[model samples]
Target: MDLTRDQVEAAVRALRPDMFDFAYWVPEMAKEYRVTSVLYSVVSATAIAHDLSPGSELGVPPPGYPSSKVLFRAHDAHALSSLSIFYKRLYHRMTTGLMNCDIISMRTCQEVEGKFCDYIARQYQRKVLLTGPMLPDPEKSRPLEDQWSSWLAGFRQSSVVFCALGSQITLERDQFQELCLGMELTGLPFLLAVKPPKGAKTIQEALPEGFEERVKGRRVVWGEWVQQPLILAHPSVGCFVSHCGFGSMWESLMSDCQIVMLPFLGDQILNTKLMTEELEVSVEVPREETGWFSKESLSAAIISVMDKDSELGSLVKRNHAKLKEILVSPGLLTSYTDKFVEALQNLLNDTNLE
Candidate 1:
């Protein structure tokens, strides 16, 4: 609930101008609290109201204390994926608007890299500072294999295709049905972690009618939630069809699977563009006039990417290996963080830094 109008006005008036320099640890936290729009407006307003010069560098940090490193080392995909998305959105906003902060974006999306580089070059006239698409070390991730094996049961070999979209976006019904059909066309065992649309009860209702039985045991498994990182790491997962959210993209890449990009909204389209254009890690699926994906298009995209022997698949695998190496390296992220903080401190000391 909102405070009284007088209270809000007073609070606004009392807003400390120095808070403009304060970093937001996680942009997604506002979304969790259902106050994302409000927070966005407040930050924009405060910047405008105070005539605060946008800082030369925005020093955005991923959520939590450095101890998250030790705490989450052997954790599931969910934790790592969530933090990655948080950092991405935070950096995007910092780089985009009047706030004018240099963001430490993870090097996962080509779009983020492109926009950040352009912002640094054309806008800030400087070099961009990037962290990693920080990966859990392979040695650390290896121990989780047996645990995932027990969770996946019979689908433990190289048969399953893991499908996941990130937390922010949802699919319209038509899109969902088309995706179902695409899975059917794959002729591979699939596990899809799909959140239902705003009001739908079962995916069966939202998916193409009779679509469930069409694939039955051989081709499909659908749930509102699945252990995605586990699914990605599973030996059975042959491919990934994803929304190109940085989290899913990183997980899938680290899994060494071929990817098909179906970007829906936000920076995702940009991320997908990067995945296709710069990194060559995946193929882009076409969206129609209204930016919706259709069954025919989805089917074609899926078939094109899933072929193990295809040139496109080989290119994707090669690129993923390169990117994955950057992500899983030890102390790489810490080094980035140290450099970022040093940059920020230097900027704070220089009046003409920006």
Candidate 2:
């Protein structure tokens, strides 16, 4: 086939941005992190389409993602995307498989990892690392570490609650009020990091009037930002009240902190459910019939998780310690990252690239 210069230039113009992004950032990030290779998790169609050509291979399609979407949603998901047919066709030609390492233990994830191993890995020949959770190095947060250690010295072990909903999550006034009141009612020393809601003039404006004054130095401390992993690792931190994001969940588990789950999304819901129901390392606060919960219920949940003598509390602490051991054990992260690098190296050495 003859290719015209105009055709070539048009293709170059279209593909230049992706090629530049990959070439520039991937190498920079790899060197900074001291990693041999990086794998990009699929967020958009570019990776799938760039690597796997349409009409190159034909089959029912790959099993894990697009195919699952097709299988589950049937006509609904497909109808919504003009590229649905493209994805259906693309995965059939996905000759190279992928690997996913777990940040939580297989036991903690409750066979969700097992099912992926059985289905996604076995069927697609993908690799998954389910070794253990990886934690951030606390040494990086030196100032925060110093402050935490000094502040926590006055408190006994497992006496303080570390509360942070993370950077992106913001609670409505009702929710925020309830949470604050509940923490106050617990009568335990606590640290809370929060962001003012959007359009709020001040972080002070995010809460109910007189709320801060009532709680000031009573039992709760509020900050705009606190180093999270360091705080969790502090001996004074007995419990973690979190939004149940995967990052927070893993951090809490790795730190052996009892989890108080208040999840708002699907992945979080699943993770929190696993922690509360399956792993017995966390508890969920009860809500009212109208979807708004009382401060009283929240206080009760906190008390249960914090109380060493209570049955459920005892169970949660025990399991949390066990999970924390698994999370912090050495060689899990090294082995997984090594395997990932080796896999990418193998891919690079392959003669299949165009």
Candidate 3:
């Protein structure tokens, strides 16, 4: 009723570039047109990129799915090469990913250690450009952004801290104040994105009295949310204080910012451990066996991540740079497609004759 089909198509094309996670969606569009050669897609109400011959749309979904697609990496293009070597023992628990049912059969990962997919069918991880947490509405993001630039202007590159726990992570009142005090003690320039606790209207209400005045002119305090990628990518932001949500972690790494992990819950705890132990890209705030945390420990964590002279800090800095290099490499996305095509060819058992 509003526009002709052509007009609608043009609008979609024009808007695609600015869409959320547009980078991932580009490949999705390609698959829609059958441009992708490797991943078998059976298009229905739900789009399923199956573990089948490249370009193979086998009419109907099998009962369990992927009797032919190899489950895990038989090789490393960061692509899933083959199916489970352990299918016999876990067959009942596992089933083929049904696209209509909202399952990603597999994906590529940046590193071997990165999570690819879930356990049920076949899944893995690969780096893709994240879409959210970019610059906020220019009109709304003003004055504060200007202030960040001004505050960071005198600092050296990779020097300041940008703190933004995602919207989901809310701190207890005492914990919030403790961290605020810690940042104040660091004396290093920082931007804290504060979210109000449940039952609170604004973050300021949770502040310990005079805490704002104490840190006034010394640190930057922001509202419930900010354009995190913008802050992380800022030249002056060397360290990121976060709750270690996977998206935030990736954004930080992509922006070349070192992590100061303050994990609050389940996967976050595991993620912080992995980022520290396996990737060596972040340092966790110290805690005791009883899982107690202190303002002193919080302060020390900020110092450790930002002070490159310290040993762990130095190691984290190097890893941060390395991760950034991998994330922004021009060839990374191309390689994901290339690997899928290669795997698809293998599945069809079709090779070019020499």
List lDDT for all candidates, in order: 0.53, 0.56, 0.54
- In model 2, state the lDDT of residue 172: 73
- Lowest lDDT 10-residue stretch of candidate 3: 73-82
TM-score of each: 0.63, 0.66, 0.60
Put down candidate 2 lDDT per residue, 65-105, tens digits, no spaces: 32222121121221124234545653432332232221111
Better of 1 and 2 by TM-score: 2
Task: Assess the local accuracy of residue 305 in candidate 3 as a C-alpha lDDT between 0 and 100.
Answer: 70
- The residue-by-residue lDDT of candidate 1 on 1-354, one tens digit each, is 223435433443465221122123222322232221111221211111111123422222123211111121121222335445644555445434323333322342232243333333343333444444555555555344454466456774656776777676666666676777777776767777677755677766687778777777656545455667766766777778898766676677667777888766434554555567756788876766555666677667766766767777777778887877875567655676577557655554552343
Q: Local error of candidate 2 at 62, Å?
A: 15
Worst 10-residue lDDT window, candidate 2: 101-110
- Model 2 residue 251 distance off true place after TM-score fit, in angstroms: 0.7
Tell me each candidate's RMSD, in Å, in order: 11.9, 9.8, 12.0
lDDT of 3 by residue, 7-93 (tens): 544555665422211122333443343232222221110112232212322232233442232122112111111122223332222
Residue 204, candidate 1: Cα error in Å is 3.7
RMSD of 3: 12.0
